[model samples]
Target: MSVRESTFPGVGALRQTGRLFALAASVVRLTFKRPFQKREFVEQFWFIASVTILPTALVSIPFGAVIALQVGSLTKQLGAQSFTGGASVLAVIQQASPLIVALLISGAGGSAICADIGSRTIREEMDAMEVMGVSPVQRLIVPRVLAAMLVAVLLNGLVSVVGVLGGYFFNVIMQGGTPGAYLASFSALAQLPDLYISELKALIFGFIAGVVAAYRGLNPGKGPKGVGDAVNQSVVITFLLLFFVNLVLTAIYLQIVPAKGS
Candidate 1:
């Protein structure tokens, strides 16, 4: 490549990075600035929670049940029935909750935000905010980002609890596992660290969703076609980022934190 051409790519990448950092910093600062806006916060919080709960509950419950069934069958063959709870609980806590809910937000909630903002951008509503001396980052971006993180944490907690309960209920109530034993095994093996890691994943993944959606919407080219394109691109990129970040976070969590009592 010619020097000028190569420099163009580097410059573009640097500009993108700078914009991303600026948005993230703005989001963090704005989240704390008007912290007493309880009414606004509660409205946004409800919107977020409503978006996340159904999917996490629906997906994780059956997922945990099926996971227990599979693990239980295998362990039964090896005369290690009690370990089913351990396997089911660990998998749900470590992988299912944040991963599944992140995907849901990527498609469901994230896409909605993208489309909403993209429409506003197309209509010049964002420009209006700019004209009025409102920082779009503070007014538009911060609440949603904070809400996403809050919703993610809530969804992760709900999923983990519901999934384990569903697994236990399914195994004991329908699949011939003893109820007391299953509960005992689950409680014995599941620790706070497993839950903590999942919460961390949710928080980070939520932030990624917010930033990815906002970045795509806020930087669209122009016009109706641009809005449509931004929405499509936003969904694809948000999904990709969610999965990629999930993998990296999982790796870091595993490396930095030893197993419970290990």
Candidate 2:
């Protein structure tokens, strides 16, 4: 392919990125303007939470169990089996919780948001609202964004707890590790800061997923096919952005929060 052809895609991506950022800023700005949509926010929160809770719990348990199994085996090899709980807890809290929440947000919540908005766009509801002098960003997007952020933080905590418990069960019952040792060592390498960082990561991830979904949905090209494509793009774009954000956040957290006993 010609250099120009390759460059065109990059240029278009950059433009899209800029538009998403601008839309996010607009949502944030409009969120605090008077006459907040309390009903819409509450409804969105319930919708997102109801859809995500079961899936998040199911995913969290397996994730925790897998981590426990792997960490337990490695620790045994290193003669550090007693520290299994500590390692598992740290992994679940610092890494797994935020990542899982992000994936769920994108896979479940993001797609739903995209499809809902896309349908409204295809039906010309958005245009009707605009013609009526209503700001769809403030009325529709802000509530979803705020709800995602709130639910994500709560879901992160739930995932962390479930993951740790799953790890405990796996390590003690499945792997023949001592239950007392596993419980005792859990806090040995964890601290308050880890929980704080995990919540923060979830909040950021939720906001990004919500914003990206909203942007894609709001700007769908033209028809039923456009709605389907927008939903697909929203999930893909949210995942890509979330992974990059997670990497950067993880690095920053590690640099700022010294490990326990370090």
> What TM-score does structure 2 among the candidates reach?
0.94
Candidate 1 residue pairs that clash: none
75-172: candidate 2 lDDT, tens digit per residue: 99999999999999999998999989988988888899989988887787877888898888888889999999999999999999999999999999
Steric clashes per prediction: 0, 0
- Candidate 2 lDDT at 25 equals 87
- Candidate 1 has a TM-score of 0.85
Q: Which stretches of candidate 1 lie over 4 Å from their true place?
A: 1-18, 34-40
| lDDT at residue 255 of model 1 (Cα atoms) | 96
Q: Model 1 over residues 1-262: C-alpha lDDT tens digits?
A: 0011111123476776677667777777777775344565567678767876787789998988888888888888999887787778888888888887777776777777777777777677777877787777777777777777888888888888898888888777766888777767777877888888899998988888888777777766567677677778877877777778888988998898876646
- The weakest ten consecutive residues by lDDT in model 1 span 1-10
